[model samples]
Target chain A: MKTENFYISDFCTLRNGKVSKNGEQVYSNLESENIKDFAKGIYKFLELKYPKFHKMDELCKLGFLATEILFQDMEKIDENTALVLSNKASSLDTDRKHQDSINNREDFYPSPAVFVYTLPNIIMGEISIKNKLKSENAFFVSKRFDAEFMTKYSEILLETEKATNVICGWVDLDNDKYDVFLAFLSKKGEKELTKKELNNLYNQ
Target chain B: MAELKEELKEKIIEQLSLEDVEVSEIGDDDPLFGDGLGLDSIDALELIVLLEKDYGIKLKDPKEGKAIFESIKVMADYISKHRTK
Candidate 1:
């Protein structure tokens, strides 16, 4: 077995999931049943001040805020940091918003602000733009969060000399529900990042 | 003209998401674009939509927006004469 000597040095879990890092939960409202409200609660807890965050679609905001939490603690960042995020809806939340704007074309014109986020990758672009990290990025449309696929792909990025670190996760969002879990994978941890570890972290 | 300019300033702030700006700070002669208010091209399009939706004014050409959207006073003067809604 070729060991990549990687580890998920840092991570952030959002939405309704239960996980604790640094003695603080990223989002602690597991029983709220209102995902949108939970996302907002987490954003406020983080006290983010990016004005553009208000303009993003809910899905993009979820992903962006989660990535903000994940990147908050990191001191030094690699230039070739990569992102491999997936979502079951694949921008459907924003797509629906865009559709609503156009559906009422006779009454209201389609808004460019809402229409611009009609792609799933726009979330990644938002993160990339905020961080000024222009690394290799890919947004996957999956039936669900495939831990094995995320684990393997990020490992490949490390082995093939593509990225020094991989930010991988699932940012799934619908009308009032969202599940965003992001992890930073780097080969400089105490232990290697494995499928079992990713599965365990994701299921948390 | 005073009331029209005041209303136009409010509309510009609401339409352009200039949350940090207050109507009192915006002079009637201040440029709406560039470093004056720091509005961009997308804001110009939104202003066009604002005219059509609220005042029933449709600009035939995008270039016409530059002059019309020069300032709150100018926009108010245009809308006062052209407003259908």
Candidate 2:
């Protein structure tokens, strides 16, 4: 399989209850009670534009949205499309809250609420359900982020023809802060994706 | 009684993070659950805690809270009857 073309369809970010464009805050007043709500708010925003979104948890919302953006023009993205996601926190916010519940004498038991969000891959599950994608899915935790890892895994998916298109990004949610960046890589030789391109797109 | 209802409304707003809703928007008889303020099960739990902490009413079952917390008027009435504090 010869891997060649890929492009980004659409991307969104919510910071401090506001959508930022090129580092400028736009569309403020996002109502989110927690980190999950922040993720939900973004999902709700995109769901309006993309009708295919199936309501689910935050991580999946991120994945489904990324997949939607990747395959918006296509009729359907089959199980062959690989999903590669990276995050630093890896549901640490949920873990910390669950730990707090366990430590607290009044609520010493872990609520299923907190435990459900503990896994790093729940986002992928959300994406799979929404897009009906059963292709390869990977979740990695890094001290910062390894671009090489993303490129390498994406290459494997393409080379194997397991996926004609690859959806990859970094999504991290900690406390009140959340950030996400995703891109679609295809084998059609549309645009050459370089380290510089990824850095430039994400760094901003 | 009116004061308690107002306070309850404020507490509901604060607890639920209904940032967009104003006190004026919540009428005394307005439904707190479905279409009125659009609160969900989580908000109901928070309200239960509010009832216990503020009004000295402990509902042994969450199901019992459904009828008692139908609206601000209903909650205030239930609290008046059951409040130990």
Candidate 3:
């Protein structure tokens, strides 16, 4: 197996009503403990007016807002860039809502709006539409964030030239508890995409 | 008719999750889909569900929605005539 080093060009994390980039804080919402309000605060802080944003579920909002922060000061993401995201909950938050809409025999109201977000990969779709990225994308469901898998999968895309860049991270939300860590990877950057570095960034 | 229109506008906003749109902003003849309100096919389904859930009016033929959902006035007329609840 040929091993080649890749660099994390930029990264963003959204957790606990706070948003950070490259280990520095960009925005914080101490007042709003709810992920919905926190994500909305980030959107307002960024001054984004995308109307579709209001329609996304909680998990998609987290991933979408994190990506927005990740690319705020950077150039437009390459259309050839791939997206590789993993999350533990896998849209369970929205799934429960959708299920509840039909759980009652008397008040059954299965909303298409909520049902459309039952899958985890729909977040990738929202991000792709916003960034206009038409590259390879994958969503993995795991019990926890697997730094090694993310690193290796992203590296394979970079090495094979299948993508000029890769956006990799964990965007997990369940029961109002959420964590998002997005890293943009390419051939040139200040930090190498090693397992240790990825884990450290995730922990940071 | 005027009262029903007002009620329909409120229900549409709440049912469709039109968070940014105001009740007064939706004119009687404003298009519900495409450029008028920026609604999509999913929203179309949502409108169908709303018709059944709120007004007890099930849309037997989905194609009838285009004309009925064309505007608030049209939806009010349809619901007033067809609503069982």
The per-residue C-alpha lDDT of model 1 at residue B81 equals 92
- Candidate 3: share of reference interface contacts reproduced: 0.63
Please list the C-alpha lDDT of all candidates, in the order they appear.
0.80, 0.68, 0.91
Candidate 1 collision pairs: A6-A187
Ranking by DockQ: 3, 1, 2
CA shift of A46, model 3, Å = 0.8
Clashing pairs in 2: A4-A187, A4-A189, A5-A188, A5-A189, A5-A190, A59-A123, A60-A123, A80-A163
| Tens digit of per-residue lDDT, candidate 2, span A63-167 | 555455445466766666677888898888668876886896764444443466678888887677667777888999987656677777777777777887777
Indicate whether candidate 1 or candidate 3 has the larger lDDT. Answer: 3
lDDT at residue B35 of model 3 (Cα atoms): 80
The interface RMSD for candidate 2 is 7.3
Candidate 1 TM-score, true structure as reference: 0.85
Candidate 1 deviant stretches above 4 angstroms? A1-3, A17-41, B9-31
Positional deviation of residue B75's Cα in model 2 after best superposition, in angstroms:
1.4
DockQ of each: 0.37, 0.06, 0.77
Docking class of 2: incorrect
Which stretches of model 2 miss by more than 4 angstroms? A2-4, A10-84, A94-102, A106-140, A148-167, A173-179, A184-190, A193-200
